[model samples]
Every structure is written in C-alpha cells, then in structure tokens.
Target: MPSGYLDLAELEQRADYVKTFEGVHIPGLLQTEDQIRAIFAASVPKLSEGELEVRVRFRLRRQEILGGVPYEAVIHEAALRIRAADSKVARGQVLQILERSEHPQVTVRVVPFAVDGFAGIGDPLTYAGGPVPQLDTVLMDTPHGGAFLDAEAQLARYREVFSKVEEAALEVIESRQFIERVVRSA
Candidate 1:
C-alpha cells in the first residue's frame, strides 16, 4: 500500500490488456526474482533484507495477471544491454524474457539502436486497456508514486505514443533472435 502496489495491481487485474514500454530497465512483470532483488537493493534509502524480500514477493505475485490476460512489452535495446546485477544475473534475466516471450499471451518486441527517427527514450509507461474505451488508463511510475491518466485526450496521446513506439520495435521473432545474440555475447 505504501508503495502504491495495491492500486496498480488492482488496475492490472481489472484490465483486459496491458502494454508497457521500458527504455532503461526491464518491466517489473517480466523481471526474474534475482533481477528484482538487485533492483530493490539499489533503493536510495536502502531497504532491509526483510523489506526487500517482501517487495520481491509482491512483484512476483503481480506477474500472475500475465497468465490471465494478454501482455505486450516493447523494450529498448539499452534496457537489454544494461546489467541490472552481474553478468550472470543479466544473462539469466534476458533468458527468462526469451522464455516468457514464447507464451501465447505474451509478446516481447525490441527497439534496436540502429532504428532511425526514434525518440521514445523518455520515462517508461504502461497502458492498461479497460473493458471499454472510456475506461482505459495510462500509468507512468515516478519515484514518488504512480500517475494514472484516464481523460480522453491523455489516453489518446498515450495510445498514439505506444503505437509509434511499437512500430519502431522489431517483430517478436526478430526480437527473440536479437536477445539470443545478446545472450551469446554475454
């Protein structure tokens, strides 16, 4: 509750579809436990071991929504390249992404560095599609908390932004291959 996890989790649970874009780090739902642990270990104020484990469990629990609904993640190449923990952990994390991409309800796309006319290197965003167009919400996470937008205009803008970002990414199959290359290099 203090982390606003409950609010975001509830929204994801009620949504029919979820799409996320990440430029700096892997999306939480797709992260491995080790990866999540590494991320929490870097918290500014620092968390105790108990607190870190609790957060990790909460994050892992949130991934259950992916099994019930379609989830699409369009991640930038930079996120794939960055080492969240160590080489072993980073490689393991990408491998997990590759494995998850094969799921029927999961789609993973890559935006390579060679792509031209691309400018979506800003903060990450998650667009959750509600049952009706009027119910859709766009979520952007900040250090302070989650920001939810449901106004027609704001939703339309984010939808367009997500469309453009998805267009810039490689196809699912190509993304798998690209990730394989990254794994091999690691």
Candidate 2:
C-alpha cells in the first residue's frame, strides 16, 4: 500500500467494525475497478500505468476486509451521480454497490440532495472500531495525504460527525431504491 493508504489498511485489518461517511466520492470499500482506476488516473501528479495498477490492486485487496467485519456506509447523493469515469463506469459502480448492499454485514444508506438539514462536514471519513473502544481510529483524506486520528478527543468528535451523517441518510431500503433510480437514469 502507498504511504497514504498504509495506516488505513492496517486499521481496517485490525478493526472489527467500520462506518464511513462519504460526501463526495464512493467509499473505497464499495468502489469498482473502473472507479478506482479513474480516481488514480485523475491524480494531481498523474500516475503512470504501472503505478495506477499497483494502487488499484492494493485498494481491491483492502476491500476484502468488508467480508470479515460489519460495515456501514452513509453516502451522499453526489457520489452516486458523479461520473468519475464514463457513464458506463458510473452505472456499473452503482450496480456493484447495490449488490454489495445485499450482504448481511454490509449496510448502505444515502443522503439525497433533498435532505434540507445536512450540509455535510468537510471531507469523507472512515471510522474503524478496534477490538477495544480506546483503540478506535478515524481516517480522513487531506491534500497532503491520509490523516489518522486516534486521540481520545479526535475520536469523540468524529464519532459525533458520523452519527449526524448517519442520521441524515435514508434507510437501507430507500438507499437501495435511490441507487436503482440513478442506475435507471444512467
């Protein structure tokens, strides 16, 4: 994994539960191959073909953690509508998310544009719960790279943020229907 992803991957591996709040992009755990490739292809410095493939592989591998632990995602509607790749890739991404949402341990919720109260925090964040509460960690992306927050106060703040985001999201069934509507439009 790259430096930006090392700590996140390690935390995912050690976590027994995970919750993510994404306001702009699809959670990495739910993104498809094309989506991941498109994201890397649009990087600031521009990754070479080999570098892109390596990073894609690392992310795909990290997704394997989803099957081993409970996972919940509160995704903003913008992520579902964005064409990070082409229309085909965007449609496929939504389809994959819908399929994954069927998993017993996987929960997907969406916060639609119609939601009046939630404007979203700043960036997307992943809250990984370790075996013990004190071991919990929060990961958020920064312009520099991924930032890890494990301090008690930081964890507490992120927990509240996650709770608010989750509260604003639609129920699981509604989210699946919302995604289906997006796919139909695609």
Candidate 3:
C-alpha cells in the first residue's frame, strides 16, 4: 500500500464499484510492468536502479486488482500516443491496452483528438465508488501532487466532466480498433 493517494487504496479495496476517468495517461490499474517502469524512470530520473525496480513491482502489484474486479476507463488519444519511453516500449504499452480491452470487467474507451471542446482538457481525474453514491470521491492529478475531492460540489462537477468526456469518446469496441490502428502505425 505504497500509494500516497487515499482514493487509490480505497479503489483497490472496493474495485468492484469503481469507475475511472483517465485523460492524461493510461489508468494505473491497466498498465503493464514495463510501461510502469519506463514511466517511473522518466519521471524520477534520480531513482536508483533498486528503487526503480521496487516502484515498478509495486505498480504491477497494484494493477493486479484488474484480474478480479470491475472498472472502466476513458482515456484520451493524446495520452495513448505520447511516447513516454522508446518506440518498443510504446508498442508494448499499446499492446497492453489491446489486451485489457478484452476483459469483461474492464471497459476501455478512447477520446479521439478530433473531439471538439473535450471536458478533460485540463487534467485527468478518477472517481471511486463508495457504499453510498454520495460518499464517492474524485481524484485529480497535479504537477506537485494528487488531490482528492469528496465534497458534493466538486464531485458533481467532476462527474459532469467525466460524462461529457465519455460522450466524446469512442465505444469500447471502436476504441479497440482505434488502438490497434495506432499500434500498427506506431
């Protein structure tokens, strides 16, 4: 439980009721080990080799929830195509997306770049389901750190944003095709 974000831990504990909205990068629960490693290496260049390995392992372990629970993600196309690592790494990442899209418990949708006035233009956010709908929280990513939103007003705003983003995104099947097309071109 190394994740600094409380919402992440809550999501892991109650993954069956989670719905995620990812506008920047692939959601953590869907990332492969290599992709996680590459991302950490780039983001924290000073991390020692051992530390990098530990972090990558932790990330992969966190992703294990995908095997047992239900979740949904709406990823922006810009996040998918951005080469955070080398070409081969990018290809592997795309392939991971293709594989995960097949899972019955997961819904992977892509918001194409052509969608005008997308709601996710600012940053990526995640909404975690609670025992009661009113208790759910919205997690927002920031350059300095992550922020959790549980206030009714903030949750309402983020929910609206996520709804609009999902509307602009392709359906799961079409998203898989779009991802495959991008992977081939990559």
Prediction RMSDs, each to the true structure: 1.1, 1.0, 1.9
Least accurate 10 contiguous residues by lDDT in model 2: 1-10
Q: Please identify model 2 stretches exceeding 4 Å from their true place.
A: none
Per candidate, the number of residue pairs that clash is: 0, 0, 0
lDDT value, residue 109 of candidate 2: 99
**Candidate 1 runs further than 4 Å off:** none
Best by lDDT: 1
Backbone clash total for model 3 is 0
lDDT of 1 at 170: 98
User: How does model 1 fare in lDDT?
Assistant: 0.91
Q: Indicate whether candidate 1 or candidate 2 has the larger lDDT.
A: 1
Q: Which regions of candidate 3 are displaced past 4 Å?
A: 1-7
C-alpha lDDT score of every prediction, in listed order: 0.91, 0.90, 0.78
**Clash list (residue pairs), candidate 1:** none
What's the ranking of the predictions by lDDT, best on top?
1, 2, 3
